[model samples]
Target: MTVLQWTATLVGLSFALYIGIAIWSRARSTSEFYVAGKGVHPLANGMATAADWMSAASFISMAGIISFLGYDGSVYLMGWTGGYVLLALLLAPYLRKFGAFTVPDFVGERYYSQTARVVAVICAIFVSFTYVAGQMRGVGIVFSRFLEIDIALGVVIGMGIVFFYAVLGGMKGITYTQVAQYCVLIFAYTVPAIFLSMLITGIPIPQIGLGAAEQETGTFLLDRLNGLHEELGFAAYTDGTKSMLDVLAITAALMVGTAGLPHVIIRFYTVPRVRDARISVGWALVFIALLYTAAPAVAVFARTNLLNTVTDAPYAEMPDWFTKWEATGLISFEDHNGDGLIQYVGADAVDGTGQPVRNELTIDRDIMVLANPEIARLPNWVVGLVAAGGLAAALSTAAGLLLVLSAAISHDLLKRNWRPDISEKGELIAARVSAGVAVIVAGYLGINPPGFVAEVVAFAFGLAAASFFPVIILGIFSKRLNREGAIAGMLSGITLTAAYIVYFKFVNPAANVAENWWFGISPEGIGALGMTVNFAVAGIVSRFTPVPAGKEGRDPAEVRELVERIRVPRGSGEAHEVSG
Candidate 1:
């Protein structure tokens, strides 16, 4: 079979497996629909969580960013991976102990107000929708490139698969399917890196190979990459161009935002106990680290290979991969002097013919990971594996996001607010309907992407950090934070963050908005600012308003009880069910 045919068959088989699993494990109640019946083993939950957390951006875009940006790209690596530490230490245990099916459920019960629940639902939908848009777009890109299908048709096929599993099985189906996806994606991601690493550095372990001496240059792999980058007028591989303060702020935003994402947070609810939740995060990080650590290796190898291939090579002899990617508009080169020889030099260098050689070769960063194996002239099977991995990453996250979107509508908004008398069967139908609607919206966004995938995803994270993280954290830890404060804080935080992003992303003309960002901080990294505003607004508003009455108020006794329960170890053999 041709590469496209093979890819189609692999992807189709994977989808069929997921659909079969979903039919077999369809949710039987509201509890199962929302939290997978809370019976998932800690290790299994960890794998599922890893798949859910590492979306299309992580799988397809991150290594590519690192390849071009060098050390500056460490922010995404450090920010995304480091957040798990925060999740394991501060967030997961307490949330699992809270014993709620959804994030909105926690907000409503903790704040003792339906308004707070509604606000949480809205925030969840907003974050999930923005995230799902990128995932669907990623699916389309993979399908179009590997399966040779039209982009819109690819998106529709992906949407149909996600809708089938998510609507049929809810969180239960998604969790198991995510485990399988985690395996597919990780295998797809690491195999090429290992092959490339061994070929270039004579080391089998890509992570260590990245830091080892290069076989050709006899210098550290990173040092060689840095030298190459300097020659090309790019930033040094080990240093950054952004200010330290901006780096600090952006990293902080990503870390907190990762911890705050509603869909990620809800994964803890699937586990059986608070301690299991904590342990699960540790395992999730371990699984994620396998890919995370290998990514830099892939980046360095791909960058070195790319530079070596095109530099001084005859233009007519450029590799097939180069021409193919150029056709996709992801890779481009211009022969300014018409010498038929490609010249890649520092940004300020004069051309080989004595004319100024401006950095005019434009290559999209996303192509780095997807096109790496092909660029390195690896076997076609390796390229096929990467295709599978990219699809797995996109589909797994899309399924999880769609599940949350449907739950927000059917469970939080419809059943809780609009139709309190709805039965379990009716609620299930509502969830399916909501899933169908969400799939349509996500597919549309995928076909007509509004912005770059990474940038759009970062906006979603910022929104989630600003609106949901503060409310959930404060509700659990601070007894004095009231429902009025929670609702007001979320609305204010989301509004401010959205306005800033819109202005910076769409309105401002001078900034390139794309490159010249605010104080060197990109829109993707501005969640820290929004989060600070959220905390300040919530605190000030709460102090001025009277404490809520009854269970909503500052109940020292109940607070102590909840804390104690959360702190209890799983080995204590105490029942893990949520006891009101």
Candidate 2:
């Protein structure tokens, strides 16, 4: 069969399998809808968590950015994976012990205020929407490239699939589906990487192959990459230009944000035991690290392979990969001096006489991973496998995010706080309806994206860091923190971070520079500043305010009980009743 036909077959079969699971495990109650009846096993939950966490940014754009950013890209690697450590150590087990349906449920109940719950619902929706848009865009890209379909149509196809499982079976459907997705995505990601690593270095392991001697040149792989960069007047693959402090801020923000994201946090609440929550985090990290470690190796291989193929070559002799990417407008060439040869270099590169050199090649960083198999001249099946993997990465995360959105609207907002008399069947119906609405909204945004996939996803992390991380941590560890403090911290942090990103990214694009940035930190790194502000505001506000009291004046006692329950770890409490 043809490559496109094979891709269609695999993607179709995968979709059918997921849908069948959704039908078989359709949610019967609000409990099944919201937290999967809190019955998920640790190993299974870990696989689902891994699928939920590794979005399109992880599977597709990360390697591409690493190829161009060199050492600077370590921020993504360090920030994302490192955050799992914080989740395991600080947040996951405790949240599980709380036995809540969602993050807002914990925030609202812990603070003893419906006001706090409402605010958390807003933040959850905002962050989830921001994150899911990127996933939908990834779905569009995969479809557009592999199936020769329009991006809009691809998003619709992705939306239809997600709506089927998420709306029909809620968390129960998404959990099992994500496990299948993890298997598909991980296999797809590793297989091409293994093949390319073997081809480039004659070594089976990508991480070791990245540093070993190239089979043909007998020179270290990194050394050859460096030589190519120098010859082309580009930054060395081992070096970068971002300042250390900026890197630190970005990495720190991503770590905290990854730990605090509502979708990932909700995964902990699905497990029946607190210990499972703790161990599941470790397993999820192991799954994530598999792809995280391999990404840089793939980046190195693609960069080195492209340079070797294109440098000093005639325009007419360009490889098929070049032509294909060029068609996507992700790669372009201009022969300014009328020479048929392409010269790709940094604008700062110059001749000995101080005359600036013009780079003829323009390549988008996002195409690196997608074009890897083609660049290596691998089989069409490998390319098809990569397509399936990218879709799995995108669709799995999108489904998880939509489920959270539905939980926030149907569980947290409607049933728990606003309309407390809603019946179980009614709430279940609301979950499906909300998921459907979210899918449609996400599809629209995907067709008209706010930014590149990875960049938009970074905004989600920044929002999570600013709004959720500080308050949630303080709620668990600091017994004196009050409702007013949590509210103030969340509002202040989210406001400042959102305003900065909007101003720099949209209002005055030219002002987005190191010289003009606050503390030399770009908008991408501003979450660190926001997080610090949250910590300070909450501390100061709590010190000045009275301890929160419920209508019956028992909030302080309730808070004490909450702290004790989460800490004891022996008896994780019952999952919240899903019926309003």
Candidate 3:
């Protein structure tokens, strides 16, 4: 079959499977809708968590970013993986033991204030929306290319798929569907890596192939890539352009933000026991490692392949893949010198004839991974598989984030705060309705995204770091932290981070360069600063404020006891189920 036919078959089959699963595992109560009835097996939950955690950013954009940015992209690899470690070690078990349906639930109960819950709810919704926008856009990109449709229409179709499962079955359906998605995405991701590795390096294992010598050139793969980069006036593949301080700040923000993401944190709440939560974390790390370890190799393979095929090539003689992508407007070339040869070079670059000329190519970074197989002349079926994988990765995360948004609005805002007497059935309906609305909003954002998939996702992580990480950490570890401090910290941290990002990204795009950044920290890394501000403000305010002595909050002694209990692990008892 042709590539288009293969893509439609694979994508249609996957969507059908997802819809079937949703019908089979439809949530009957709020418990099932919110946390899969708190009965998921560790291994299944691990796969589901991996699928949810590895969004479109991880599957489609991470390798793409690394391909273009070279060594500067290591921040994403380090920060995101390290952040999962932080979540598993420092946050997961405690939050799971707290028996809450959502992050805001923990904050509301721990801080003993509806006000804190409301703030957390708002933060969760905002961060989730920001993150989901990237996923939806990724879906649009894949559909626009493989399905041969407009990106806006692709996003609408994707929204319909997510709405069916996410609204119908909630966490229960999303969890199982994510498990299937994990299998599809991992298979799709690895198969191409193996093929590229063998084609380029004569090694089937991508991890080892990345360091091996090229089949034709005999030089090391990275060294060859570096030579190509320098020959084209680009930075060396191994040498990064970002300063050490900025790298440190970006890494820290992503790490903290990963631990604080509402969608990821909520995964732990689906298990049957606290030990199962920890076990699921371990299992998730193992599953996540499969793709993470292959991403760098994929980046190297895709980058080397792209530069060789495109640079100084004839536009009329370009491959079929080039024209397909060009039609989508993600790749374009202009004849600056009227020579008809593609001048795909960096600034101040000289052509093959040794004449200095302007760069005449514009390629979107997000296209690297999607176009990799075609660039390497891989099989049509493999290309189709990747299209399916990209959709799976994007839709799985979109479903998870939408669930977080819906739960924040329905459970935290309505059931807990505004309508304490709301019935469980009413809350469930509201949750489904909210998810439907969120799908429409997410589709619109996808049609008009703020930036590329990875950049938008990084901004969302910054928001989560600024708003949620400190408060959640303090709520778990500090007994004296009251509603005032928690509320103050969240509001101040997120506000500062949001305003800085908006000013740089939207308000003053011309001044977004490093010279204009405060303390040389870019908007992406500013979340670390915001997190520090949160910690500082919470600490200072908690010190001068009156301690809770059973007056307007939980008893001071009880709060301390609660902290100690969460710190110490209990036996493998049944999971504590929170009432609706």
Candidate 4:
């Protein structure tokens, strides 16, 4: 089948599956709606969490970034995956033991203040909306290219699918549908990567294949990539040009940011026990590692293939996929000396006069992963699989983020505050309405994206790390953190980070000096710095102020009892003990 046919068939089937799951598992109560009735199997919840966490950025843009940036891209791989370790170790289990429907609920009850809860709701909405915008745009891009639809119409179609299941099934619908999406996306990502790996290096596993000796060149695969990069005037693939301090800061920001994201943290709430939450993260990582490990290999193979095919080949002989992508204005070729052949070289290759000796081509880095299989002469079905995978990644993440967005509005903002006595049915309707509103907002943002996918996603992660992670961690672990301190800390962190990013990314066009950065860190990594400042400020302020009466301490007996129950395995047929 052609790419369009395969995309239509696979995407249609996936949508049908989601609708069926939503119908069969329609949430009947608030608990079911928010946390999937708290009966989801650990493994199943793990798969859903994997899908929830791996957004369109991971599926479509990560390898492309790695391809263009080379070793600098390792920061993303390490930062994103390492954050799961922090999640499992520091946050997930305790939140599960708290037995709340959302992260804000835990913060409110733990801190004994509605103000803290409201601050958390605001943070959740900001992080979810910023992150979901990229997913919606990714969905539109996939549809426009593979489904032969306009990008705006594609976004609307994707929005409608999200509305169908997210409104009806809530977390229950999202969880099961995410499990199916995980399967489709993972298969779609890995199969083509394996094919490319075998074709290039004669190795099946991309991770090992990347390090193995190349059949064509007697050197290691990475060494070959590095050699090719230098020949093309680009930085070596195994070494980075960024300063050590910047790399460390960026990695730190992404790690803490990953742990702080509301959508990911809320996934732990769906499991039945604390141990399930802990073990489920390991499973989620296993699934994530499948694509993460393959991504580097895809980057190496695709870059090599692109350089070989386009470097000396005439424009008329260029591949069909090249013409197709170039028509979208994503790929371009310039013949500076009227040489006819496209030159793929680094920016630094130009002479001291700031003029190129050869023609330069500029290709959008985002197209690398999507066009890799086709560029390498892989079967049409493999290209179709990638399209499906990209859709699954975007749709699953959009559903998860939309769920959090609606819950924050309905449960935290309205049910908890505006109408404390609102009926469960009323709240459910509110949640659906909130979800519909979020979809419209996300669709609009997708149609007119603010920036490139990876950069925008990084900014969102930085915000989450700086503003939310510190608040949630201190709320649970520090008894001295007062409502005033949490609010002050979040406001300060978010404000400072936003100002820094806006100034650097948009405000100052002519002044781009590294010395202007505070602490020698870029705005991309400054969120970690902001988070540290927040924690210090909160700690200092809490010391000077008196703790709210009756809210200064956790029940030690209850805490111990909860710990013991979570430590034990489930299905023992005994009533779990609780103390207060």
Candidate 5:
């Protein structure tokens, strides 16, 4: 079968499976919608969590970033992975024990203030929308290429599919669906890596193939790639370009941001017990390791394959895959010197005859992973499978983020704050309605995103780190943390971070470089500074303010007791219900 045929067949089957699962596990109550009735098995929950946590940024864009950025991209690898461990060890179980439906719920109850809940709800919505924009863009990219539709139309179609399962089944549906998505995405990701590894290095394992010598030249792959890069006036593949301070700040922001994500934290609430949450986190780490370890290998393989095939090639002799991607407007060529040959070079590059030539080709980084198999002349079925995998990675995270948005609006804003007398059934209807609206908004963002998939996602993580991380951590560990302090911290942190990102990314794009960055921190790393400001502001405010009550009209000692209980895990079947 051709690539299109294979893609349609595989994508159709996957969509059917997802729709069926949603129908089978549709939520009937608010509990089911919000937390799947808190009955998910640890193993299944682990798979679902992995699927939720590894967004399109991981499956589709991380390798692409690494392929182009080289050693500077390691920050993403370290930050995202390390952040998961931080979440698992420090936050997941405790949050599960708290028994809140959303992060806002936890904040409102823990801090005993409706205003705090409202602030948290706003933060969750802001962060979620920013993150979901990337997922929707991922969907559009896959459909635009494989289905040969316009990106805007593809986003609309993806929005429709997500709306069906997310609105009808809620967390109950999304959880089981994510388990199947995990299977599809992981298989799709690894099979192509294995094929390309053997094709390039005569080794079946991609991880080993990364360092193994090439079959034809008997030179190590990394060494060959370095030579190619330097020959083309690009930095050596193994060399780092980012400063140490920027790297550290970006890594720290991503790490803390991961621990504070509302979507990932909500997954722990779906499991049966705190013990199950901990165990599920363990299983999730193992599942996550599979793709994380192979990413650098895949990056190396794709980069090597791309450079070998395209550099200095004639435009008339380009492959079918190149033309197909070119039609999507992702890859373009211009005859700057009227030579009719592609000069895919870096800054200030000189030709073979020592003549300075401009780069004549522009390729989008997000296409590298999706186009890797095709570029390597792999089977049609492999390309199709990757298309499906990218969709799975994207859709799974979109559903999770949409749910967070819905819960924040319906549960946090309306039911808890505005209309306390609202019925459970009414709340369920509200959740679905809000989620539907969110899907449409998300589609709009996808069609008109501010940046590429990974870059937009990095901004979302920065927002989460600056706004949510400090508040969540202090809420859990500090008994003196009052609602005023939490609200102030969230507001100040998110404001500073968002302002910095906007100023550099939008207001002054020319000065986005390192020289103009405040204290050598780029917009991506400014979240760390914002987080520090949050901690300082919250600590100072709490020190000056009077000690607040744990609950309305309750004694102050109970606040200390509340923090103590969150720190310790009770036995199975113990009192797990936290009073709201």
Candidate 6:
């Protein structure tokens, strides 16, 4: 079989395995639908969380970004991984002890108001949909490239597979399916890095290979890469272009957003106890760091290889992968000065012939990981494995996000707020049906991607940092925060962040430069500002509002009891069943 056929077979088998697992593990109760009956082992839950957290952006686009952006990409490395630290220490144990099924459930019960629940649900839905759009788009990209199909048809195939498993098994199916995906993706990601590292730096471990000496030049791998970058008119790989303040802002926003994201937080609900949640976070990070740490090394290898092989080579000497990717428009070339030799520059420049040469090569960052196997000249099976890995990353994340979308619509909106009398069975049906609808909507977004996968996902993080992170933290750590204060803070934070992003992205994109940015922070990183706004607004408004009581109104005795319950970790057992 051809390379494309091999990729199709492997990916097909992987999807079939997930669907079979879903069929065998159908959710029977509302609790099962949402949290898999709260019986998942900590280690297993950690694997599932890794799959949930590392989406298409992580698996496919992140290395490409690092390859191009150089040191600026450290923001993602620190921001995404650091959030798990906050999640473990700040939120996970407490939420697990609270025994809530969803982030909205925690908000509603903590504030003792349906209004808080409604607000939480909206934020959760918005953040999840924004994130899911990237996953769906990721699926299409993998299918288009590997399976050799139309992008729209690729989305349809992805949606059909996801809809079957997601609608059938809910969280129960998703949790188990994620475990399978984690294995496939991580293996796919690391093998290429290991092979390339050995070839370039003579080290098998990627992290160490980065700092090791280059086999050819005897200089450090990093030093060699920087030399190549400067020679080619690109930024040094270790030095960054963005201001430190913007870097700090973007990193903070991503960390908080990672902790606050509902799909990720909800993974803790599946584990059996509060202690399990804490341990699970450690394991999840361990699994995630495996990829996160290696990605930069992969970037280094890919960058070094491209510069060595492509630059200054004759057009006829270019590899087959270049031609294939060029056909997709992910890569393009034009000998602007009509020189037969390729000239790649980060800026407009003259070639060796002193001809004013416009850069011939245009490489999209999204294709970096997808094209890595080819760049390394690996075997056909390895190339096919990378395709399976990309699908795994996209599908795993999409299932987790769609679960929250459907559950919030059915449980939070229909059952809790609108029709309190609805039966649990009816609620489950609603969850499944809503999941189906979400699949189609997500597929449409995939066919017409809004932006780069990671860029769009970053917007979701900004909103989460603005809306959910502060309120949830305050609700746990502070007694003075009232329902009115939380509502106001969420509205203020989300509204301001949304306005900033919409203005730069849609309203007046030309004004997106540093001078035009408010305080020189980019829209991607503005969530840090919005998060601060949330904290400040909550603190200011909380003092004026009457202290909220317990469920009916916080009596002093009930307030103390409420604090003591979540504070003490003794009673966190199986979560009681409710509508999913």
Once superposed on the true structure, which residue ranges of model 2 sit more than 4 Å away at CA? Answer: 351-354, 550-554, 571-580
Looking at candidate 5, the ten consecutive residues that score lowest on lDDT are 550-559
Model 1 misplaced regions, further than 4 Å: 333-335, 343-346, 352-355, 512-520, 550-580
TM-score of each: 0.93, 0.96, 0.98, 0.93, 0.98, 0.96
Return the TM-score for candidate 6, rounded to 2 decimals. Answer: 0.96
Evaluate all candidate structures by whole-model CA lDDT and list the values in order.
Answer: 0.82, 0.87, 0.92, 0.82, 0.92, 0.87
In candidate 6, position 294 carries an lDDT of 98
Per-residue CA lDDT of model 3 for 535-566, tens digit only, reads 99988888888786554334557656767777
Error of 5 at 26 (Å): 0.2
Clashing pairs in 6: 549-553, 549-554, 550-553, 550-554
Candidate 3: the clashing residue pairs are: none
Tens-digit lDDT track for model 5 on 11-119? 9999999999999999999999999999999999999999998999999999999999999998999999999999988898888877889999888877777888899
Model 4 over residues 1-580: C-alpha lDDT tens digits? 8777877888888789888988988888887888898888889999999999999989888888888888888788888889898988888876776677887776665655678778888888887888888898888888887877788998999999999999999999999999999999999999998898898888888887787887887788778778877766778888888778878888998899999998999898888777788778989989888888888888888887888788767888897888777766678888876877777777556655767555468887777888999888898878888898898999999999999999999998898778888999999999999999999999998888766677677788888988889977876576667767877888788778878888888799345456788767877788888888888887887778776554333443443344445444354222232211
lDDT (Cα, 0-100) at 182 in candidate 4: 98
Instruction: List, residue by residue over 41-104, the lDDT tens digit for candidate 2.
Output: 9899999999999999999888888888788887888898889999999999888888889999
The clash tally of candidate 4 reads 0
lDDT of model 3 at position 328 = 90
**Distance from true location, Cα of 321 in model 4, Å:** 0.8
What lDDT, from 0 to 1, does candidate 3 have? 0.92
